[model samples]
Target: DQQVKQNSPSLSVQEGRISILNCDYTNSMFDYFLWYKKYPAEGPTFLISISSIKDKNEDGRFTVFLNKSAKHLSLHIVPSQPGDSAVYFCAASVIFSSGSARQLTFGSGTQLTVLP
Candidate 1:
């Protein structure tokens, strides 16, 4: 049972357009969510994140929104550029009482292609 799901395997966006990537989770215990972007050869880098207590978080051109009731979340990028093309992964975590301890579950990545 995959806890986190990204139904769309891929998405294509033109430059200067907005790109939206969707994700869903089945586990209600998940308290925090994060998005990671990976280039062709490099490791996945942290993009943006949102906690269950908050609905949205923004970092420059990237924004992450969480809908706890629907168990859904999304990553939005404005003015999408070709350089932004990469595989994005959605990760959910259940924070434990052990301070930094957490159980993380990752969704299959969705490939994003940005056209110039």
Candidate 2:
């Protein structure tokens, strides 16, 4: 079973507009979440993240929000630019009692396109 899922396979936004990407998870055990942006010839790069304890986390133009009660999270990019177009992956992980984190479970990525 896919614990994490990005229901929308793709999203399109105009340059300088806000783009929102959403994700859902079935596993409540997950305590941490992250978003990764991947380009055609490069590996997925860490974009933003949030802890289950916090509802929102922001870094520059990227913001991640988590709704623990709903098992959902979303990434919002403001003033979307062409360079921001890429596949965005949502990943979740659980932290063990030993303070170590387990391997992340990733959702199928959502392709984001920014039109000029």
TM-score, every prediction: 0.94, 0.94
The candidate maximizing lDDT is 2
Angstrom error of the Cα, residue 20, model 2: value is 0.3
For model 2, the superposed segments whose C-alpha errors exceed 4 Å read: 95-101
TM-score, model 1 to reference: 0.94
* Per-residue lDDT of model 1, residues 47-86, tens digit only: 9889899999999999999999999999999989999999
lDDT of model number 2:
0.95
